[model samples]
Target: MKKVVSLLALVMLLNGCDDGNLTQEDINFEDIPTQSCSINNIIYKLKDEESLLLEIPETSFTNEPSTVGEPTLLDINSANRVVYRFYNGTVSATNICETIPPATPIVTDQWSAIAGKIQIFTTAVKTTNATDNSTKITGYNHNIVFKNITFAKNNGTQVYETFPFGDYVTTANALPFLFDQTVEQCSASKQIYNYNSSEALLLDIDPSLIVNSATPLNTPRTGLIGTTVNKLTYRLFSGLLTSGYFCTGTIPSTPTVSEEWVATSGVSNVSGIIEVTTTTLGTGFKHVIVLKNVTMKKGTNDFKLGDSFIYGELLTTN
Candidate 1:
């Protein structure tokens, strides 16, 4: 029997058959577009008030040749200057017995005593992004300023005018630093020992942004003269400055600084891009390896890579 359908029922049936609506499952998250942005060129200068005081141990000097049971007394004089080699964690005297003219005069009541202080100022330039700015490696130029240093003699005298009294500069490759806003994290690696090791820098970043880009450079192709291809490489170790922890937001009271460095592997040339992956990194920090400029060679042809000028921001989350 034909019956009049209720208005409400008719409406419901029509709505159920409609194909214009989309379900949550039907949405492709991968297809969603992300905003492309770039960080402004920011210069991060180490605060002027901040300084690192490297302490030299009195017991650092030990007698050489056939096990002297006790530590040897370092001679304090103008001719016997204490030479120090500063690494990530420790500082040692470079000249054990060889006595050269002291960079500065050493005066002390005791044979063994604290040597002096090295005042260093470090500054870095963060470069901009090229691709999706949400996740990218930024370029950096690190500058270290060494102030006129003095050594403290145990006898209350000071040795004025030591070594490293100028500015030292090093340039980084395309994205030596990474800022990931999605996770509210930032990370970078500095080559502390050119030809030796790297130091990891970790920090917190703003959580609202995302970036996906790479540091780009160009290299010459061996077979093709004057033909250069874009190649991207990381930074190399310059040298260790001082020990400190890196973080965003509030600085931790007990920031741990680790000197452990793991070498990078699996660097290959894919098309024109150089792909690098690091396996060893400190906990809570993304590790990066310092890479040298790449030179491509096939048979007799070879070329060096070049880079695009880009800059970015390096705000401390803390």
Candidate 2:
């Protein structure tokens, strides 16, 4: 509800396959806890981590302080810093950039989510002032570390706060990831408890609009995906989800296309939607258009009879 686009950024994509480099691996907490210490900055608890903070505390945290190595390709650097340990039993670390300098007054800031000794930590050190004939200024960095620190976690009294609906949508995890096929939950008996609910989506493009309309392409395949294309004007976006991929053909500009999926019986991908069967054409994939919240653009273009377009099904129409 509160404008999240500014803070929780969205990854902008150009029209094409959104295939990111994927290497299947187990989710590891070995790389979970990391910290950033900037002078005069209040560390706000990311809403998702609030619960975990209350569960663990100031003194309850174990300290196996160590030096953090530089993170590869990570925007945040952890070089020459102190590490803070916060885990069920393991220790996590963060680097300390610099500390408050002599003759400078240290300022304190606060933040929180936990009720007990959970605390907000920050310090401000005066920046270096240097200038040369070529440049006008020299800058300074802050140093952040407490003397023999501890994060004690404990609570007998309970507390709760209700955030506005739009302010924070409760996401169990980070974000909605791309379609995946891994089965969650398991047991030693190998009963295959998870029925495999993942599905691969395929989209059809009109031959006329494709760059290779006359190139004699292959038959309709079952593994097509719906990528977003903003160049054309079908204007079918509802909130944030754009379900259909755009078309770009050298010839058949206006093509009639349909979706295909397998009707997964309560245990598969088709179980939640209206799927007819489990083959390429009718295995059970149907066209779906998800509309979040709509607003009109600044200008509208009026054409005669012919206009380029793509279509999707409605949430309720199914």
Candidate number of the best lDDT: 1
- The ten-residue window of minimal lDDT in model 1 covers 42-51
The residue-level lDDT of candidate 1 at 17 comes to 75
Q: Write the per-residue lDDT of candidate 1 for residues 1-318, one digit (tens) a residue.
A: 224557777888998776443332332122222111122111111112211222223123111111223212333334323322222222112111224523322321222113433333333333333342222223222221222333443334333333332332333233233322221122432212111133333211112121232223332111111132222222323454233323334533442322222212213442222222222223322212222333333222222332311112222211
Candidate 1 CA-lDDT value = 0.27
Model 2 lDDT tens row, 102-134: 332221211222221222221111122232111
How high is each candidate's TM-score?
0.17, 0.15
Task: Name the best candidate (by TM-score).
Answer: 1
Task: Please give the RMSD of candidate 2 to the true structure.
Answer: 27.1
Error of 2 at 68 (Å): 23
lDDT of 2 at 232: 14
Candidate 2 global lDDT: 0.21
Which parts of model 2 have CA positions greater than 4 angstroms off? 1-40, 44-245, 248-270, 276-318
- Show model 1 residue runs off by greater than 4 Å: 1-114, 129-164, 176-318
